[model samples]
Target: MVGTAARALIVSERRITGLSQVVIADLVAELGPVWQARRDAELCDRPRRRAVGAGAKYKLVFVDRLLATLVHLRHGITHDVLACWFGVDRSTITRAIGEIRPLLAGRGCRIAPGLRLRTLADVIAHLGATGQTGIIDATEIRVRRPAAHRRGRNRFVSGKSRTNAMKALVVTDDRGRLLFCGEVRAGSVADITQARDAGLVDLLADTVHLEILADAGYQGLAAQTYGQVVTPPRKRRGKNLEQVQWLMAHHEQARFEHSSRRIPVEHGIAHLKNWRALARHHGHRHHLPDTIRAVAGLLSDQQATHKRKLAALPTGQSR
Candidate 1:
């Protein structure tokens, strides 16, 4: 049963991983060596009494392990379900994901060969170098409510979504390609607070030419970044009726233009949420950061592949 399902799914890679066969093959080729080295290092550090190959081998091979992890991340399948699919115990599926997930997260968001943006600094530098305008936004993912006795339980409740959730800041290029997905925060954390805590102001301060387009949630950032952070215009209060009406007209136009520029970030967030694991995290809250970043990295890889194919197409041919 496991063999049949696995073979069928492998033939149709997009169903499981939301990635093409070519992309999966490229990932396996690139990540296999690094995973092997890391495993070797772990074995050496522990100095197992049994020689190499003395213990029972993995029930799922490296490729299967990677595939299983991707499927779980993309679809949020339970470990027991994955175990049934792969013909292994639930513990095996759990261990496999624990191992492979970090590798994906560590890869960050790859834009080109030998260029991966892992941190906010890396994203800032890339945008500056490429002269691409970036769009920034925060999105929330609903999660299981915390127990009454839990410390900081209220922190998980979002004022905006009015649900127990976690939030992450997403940054994307002008064309809606993911550049960075910030660390996860409590749902109660304000978008502006998260941006400031992530050092967006300090980082963008040095990059004179790079501008970040954001929505109204990041209002104060424009002043702090010296106009580098562009946001929708705010209406002036306590003005005469004539003055207020004029300001309102001006603000409406400015807002429309700002929203158009900032729309890419919404698309970026939508793409990130397409991963079931991110749609609503059922796992421990502490693990959400790794899960979100890993999903972002995989999505970025898929986007990069699509872009390359488009570039390769003949003139006027659209995919």
Candidate 2:
């Protein structure tokens, strides 16, 4: 019965993932210039003597191929599968992706340049009436155990995957724009500990009352920074008046507003999941960090373009 139930859940995951991919593809399309710019490095880095196509005849639209790769990635498909679908070798797919990532950043996607994603207020304003506070937290990815891996460490597991792996601390703003991501760490790392180590708390503290909202994983961060936290109520032996108010939903209106504020982060994650590079990272020792930097950088570029387009749309059409 347990095995049967797990299969059902897996099927459901596959069923709904199509919606996620469509959303991801549309999002990637907005950053056409970003991908086109990387064509040279991506094609040149290939181990082959001949290009996929010469000049414009056999050329693939960087954006379309990128979208194709994203759809294939949604299922944790292998590079072999990706190569077959895209008519390239597994290594070619990998190299093309890697070479194109950094350019996606630094060029059109410089989020605050010297600083991490711009101020929380700036993010909120861009999200507009649909958003309120900045939500910050880390998300994890799963990987197969290393061959040399052994022992009771098997007790450490993730709900995301059946294999062994670690986590990356993702600090995102209210709209789900990834502001920062920490170095990969063991999944066992505590949220608070990772948050601090990743410098999210420091960023929040730099501003006064900017309202850093997160799940309960962020203990005392809200009060310490004079920001508001929106985690669900925690079950503890005791509670003080100050803490109680923070726990209360206040009213139906407050509840709706709270839900809206956190929507971006969740939606953003859904969007990121479309890129296989971010979702099922095999942690290709060499490609891991650079992949994260490129993909995250590309996602950020797409995000800014999304905001810009919405701002240009008639107010009635934007929502």
Candidate 3:
């Protein structure tokens, strides 16, 4: 976690020191077509570029601006607050977020089984680290008007909260390589429901063999799907000690150890929020979950890179 001092440093640097303007301008440049479309669509500015649009009608904005703006909204900052953060007009943000949505969605990179295999080689590294396959769990993403919030009506949930929200399913190997990211759906949906609906079973059947460790929420989903998993057993009435212990080993020993290591994955979730800068936990915020998942995947990538570098290091210093 970034300390209060670090956060203050950041806020002061951007807001008080007048870095907001330079950064926002840089972001508008970095995000390319995504920001450009937003700029033109919003009539943000008419900066001249030499045939930069190709056939497109907009000039580009930086990814950093778009990301920073997302962070502002996540923190529950108002449009005016965001304008203050960026040293721009409040309407610019509404328009930028409006245009940025489709840009991120439309750029969706489909992960074929083969790509999963290639990108997630580190799951095996995790298994080697611990004696378990991997862990699985589902989390809900709270939304405000999720129905009208995201582009797809299918992804929103109106029943889960006082407002709306979405549920996300994630699986990571023991070491934290995200194996799968199911479609974002409304929070009203059950974790298991989204797993099936999201096609996790199909993906596992075709491309994976490691056991999945999950919480009680995924009860029976393992057997129903792949006949594998190590989840904590539920304590029900009429069960004796032997029965309880017997129930425990459904990947019991491994899952316990798995949880010891796996619980840190929640930190990844926390890390995402740090980056997102959200205000309330639940909002009509649609794309934040996907961005968080993407960042998690990038974590695995980074770990893989770091590991390779370490492997190549001199033997004694390797860690």
**Candidate 1 TM-score, C-alpha based:** 0.95
Name the regions of candidate 1 deviating beyond 4 angstroms.
1-5, 237-242
Q: Which whole-number lDDT from 0 to 100 does residue 46 have in model 3?
A: 56
Model 2 C-alpha RMSD to native: 10.0
1-319: candidate 2 lDDT, tens digit per residue: 1134533343345342333333345445555666655555677777866665565452334543554444444455666765675565677666655544444333322354333343334443433333445566566766556555566465336544545556665546655777654355656666776666655555555454446567667766656556544554444332788666655635435646666676777776666667676676774644555555555655665566556667889868835
Tens digits of lDDT, candidate 3, 68-128: 4445443445666656655556676766665554443332222222233222233333443
lDDT of 2: 0.54
Best by TM-score: 1
Candidate 1, residues 252-305, lDDT tens digits: the string is 898888788877888889888899999999998878899999999999999999
lDDT of 1: 0.88
Inter-residue clash pairs, candidate 1: none
lDDT (C-alpha, whole model) for all candidates: 0.88, 0.54, 0.51
Kindly state the number of residue pairs that clash in model 2: 0
